[model samples]
Target: MEPENTTQNKPRGRVVMLVDNGVKGDSRVQKAARSAADAGWDVVLFGVSPDGEKHSWKVGSAEVRLIPKPGPLNPRRHDMRRPLFRRPLAYRSPQVARYRVQAVKAWRSDLSFRQAAVKAARAGHPGRSAGGSKARLLVPRVSSKVYSKWVALRARETTDLQQRRSMLDARLDRATTALWQGLMKQRSWRRLTPNLWDFELAFAKHIDKLKPDLIHAHDFKMLGVGARAAVRARAAGRPVKLVWDAHEYVPGLPPRHGRWLPGHVAWEKEHAVFADAVITVSPALAELLKKGHGLSQLPTVVLNAPVLSPGPDEVAGAGPVPDLRELCGVGPNTPLLAYVGGINPVRGVETIVEGLTQLPDVHVAMVSVPPGKPYAATATIRKLVDKLGVGDRVHFLPFVPHWQVAEFVAPADAAVSPLHHLANHELALSNKFFEYSQARLPQIVSDIRTMSEMVRSTGQGEVFRAQDTDDYVRAVKAVLADPERYRAAYDKPGLLEKWTWEAQAEILDGIYSRLLPDRPRIAAQPSGSRADARA
Candidate 1:
């Protein structure tokens, strides 16, 4: 650990990070942890714990704070929703006008409910004396007290639900103090998207408490928490350096899947402008931030790949990869094609399935994320595949831990990323891109700018023209036909090589050593949404 600079003149910065639900139970989170610890920075990771732990706890060298997990893993107990009491949306929207409307409505509703209930009682007891009304009264004192308490409790509970609903109605305002508290409480955002954000908050809170020199937030979902945490830290006069890693294009999130209603572009646009340094996983996204977003001030682009070597195992949440033959009844020799990660429309797993149906001899295995996740288009695709008559050939392993993903892919004849072109996918440098490369395996991927660039650079994969089923079909068939070519591709050096959390950690170590040296260091604004132009 870097020695604290107790010298009066020496400045020692203390950084506090908020990791959100993602940094827990994820290899990337572990990688972030390694980066912080290796850099000799004190880090507290606020996120939920796996297997139902109570209280905030430390994982490895970093603290892991627990946030309530969302939803029933069993599914039957609750649909993809929070209990009414936990709703953030029900409270009010973030927009002043809409939020005020909701707030006023709530105030009125609670007031009216109490007034009406009391008025009815008073009218019913019109003949009661004033002294009796005050003392013995229209009702028993115990009963009145209990009834008032129940009414107040009911109103408060109802308000919580309304707040959650309002939060959703207005679009999830992640870049604020309000969003994360829900995940920590399981009262607001946690109930909204349990799997998505619960752990992210716990990690962020712990990060905030530890006061590290540097903070790394991966992906857009966690960005809000990281930003909010930084904002809070700075407000408290803590100095922290924040590294904002963009795994995918934020504005491009919709339309890759069936679309989940709509969200405000301003939210992400504002966030993009607000980040300290916009680190992108893909060059394409870097270009987007530079060109489209007018973020002249944001220091952007420190590209990354998923770590190839063993990462933090505690967060990996993986056991040995499930045996496919035993689980699926498929012979060990059966040719398998695999697609991992959120099975959303942008991923184009449906295209992979259709393309595979053309090949006929291959099977498709989806190892990450279940079809049932509300956000996944996987279920919809499954029904479509059944209609297309290839249902049995394609299967889902659901969300395997990051550690076991390679296990699922190892048994496959090929891996693929058949993504639909979008701002998000166009700028995406997906984890699976490097995951396949680290395994030294051949892959078929979308011809999106970022993905194609990787395939061309690494020579480890074939690029199917974007969203073209025939292109996917041909690519897979060619790999199946030419084992030598596949081997040739796999033998080539990958961008995935020389880029592990270790290397990133060394860079981070240097960053912290220079930035902090003794005590913790901090950025002017620790993290999130730094626009080049003043906001």
Candidate 2:
């Protein structure tokens, strides 16, 4: 679809979408922003920039304003000597001390066990005492020398290892310090949060300036941000409406290394009550939010589907499209399996690479963007491909724009969504499910509840046991064996239409209309139309 025309008459009211992450590849936020804009609301998307650069740009009728997070908040820019000060005082509270102590004790116990085992092995056989007296005495002296020498060598090795570790630690500290000093010199601290209080304080000030009619928070973290902003706006007599758009089952999200799930769930629950309305991405997630938060009503389910065009030929764009066959240097008849979105661990991307080993003839095209930080799976996947000897069959494509994703998938024989059966993935109905349907390409989805149900009900594709390499291989092979049968499923009347953003957009519009009944609705203008009526 085309970007919304900004030259139309002035929007009736303004909406501010608060998100924690950058807006580059966020399809859900983009869709919501465009839907609101199409329905006559001026949209301002407030998000964090990746490079910590504050900037603003217009995307159709929406204006994206990004805030650069402060260096103190980023671990890469941490001053090792002063890192403790960067954490919020509340995070260093006594309650957190218990977890830290437990972790430290566990690590110490493991290290002690390893050292004890090494010492015991060096000491040697206990049964040697049963030998003859002379043999024992003579052996003990010789053994003592050997043991002493071995122990000395081990001590020297230990000292060397400790010295190396200390040197590495010092180097890391210096690097962190340099980065922190550089960021501080740039004066970007003004945009950053020294602590949670500072972040909320800055966010409130930014929200106050926008004076939005409604604050649409994208996820649980932003719910707090939006609620705080709403309070500030109301105190200033703006009285903005708050809408919590929960993209995942926050409480059920799989635990990560440093994440505090309980605290996040409690925070979301506390602030969710303040929202005028709550909406989620799936029916299952909506139910979970209602019960989890003890809400009086269930959240509206707005599936993450692509915008459907009138026909397959009208998907989007008329420009020169990149050919997957030419890009991969493969023949046209070669079976291509396309996987799109972020190549993250939880997405079961490893299974895809492993499954490709079983199917030598099938070429896998991963159309994805690189994930941030140490969590980047593209490097890992590439290493796996080389190790498994599937480098010739696997191809990695640079990030395709959301609008042009179809172009990449169109040439492929089938699309795959092999999400692991985590609580969040189990309930999620991802955009790829519908994107493949819109392109009339068959899908091979993991046997998660929501996505599996969609695939089964629509008869669009096949489902495989999630995280099972054999099952994924079998599923893809089955589709590739009979591609025509699965492709015809999309040809069914009203199937693709029901899964489009246009359908979800109506539900989103209805929620907004009820929330702001007094707000006038302007007729949508044609693309590139002049604002003659307003002029």
**Highest TM-score model number:** 2
User: Could you say which candidate leads in lDDT?
Assistant: 2
Off by over 4 Å in 2: 1-11, 51-53, 71-198, 235-237, 256-259, 308-319, 369-375, 526-535
- Residue 343 in candidate 2, Cα distance off native in Å: 2.4
User: Residues 170-194, candidate 2, lDDT per residue (tens digit)?
Assistant: 5554455346435553222222223
Native-vs-model 1 lDDT? Answer: 0.55
RMSD per prediction, one decimal? 13.4, 15.0
lDDT of 1 by residue, 1-535 (tens): 2222311232433334444454544666666664564344455554544455644544444445545555333221222344443443332222333444455556545544554555556778442232233333324445545655554554565465445444344343333324444334323333334343333444554555455555666666566566666677778887655666666665566532211212223334434544666666555677776775676644344434454444343334535557654555578777777677776666677787677667777877767555344445756887888888987887766665554455556666677888877766677666676666555567888888777886777666688887788877888887777645664765545434454444555555454555455655443221222111101
lDDT of 2 at 339: 86
- Model-by-model lDDT, in order? 0.55, 0.71
Query: How many clashing residue pairs appear in each of the predictions shown?
Result: 58, 1
Q: Which residues of candidate 1, in runs, are more than 4 Å off? A: 1-15, 48-55, 67-212, 215-238, 255-276, 291-304, 307-318, 323-333, 368-376, 493-496, 517-535
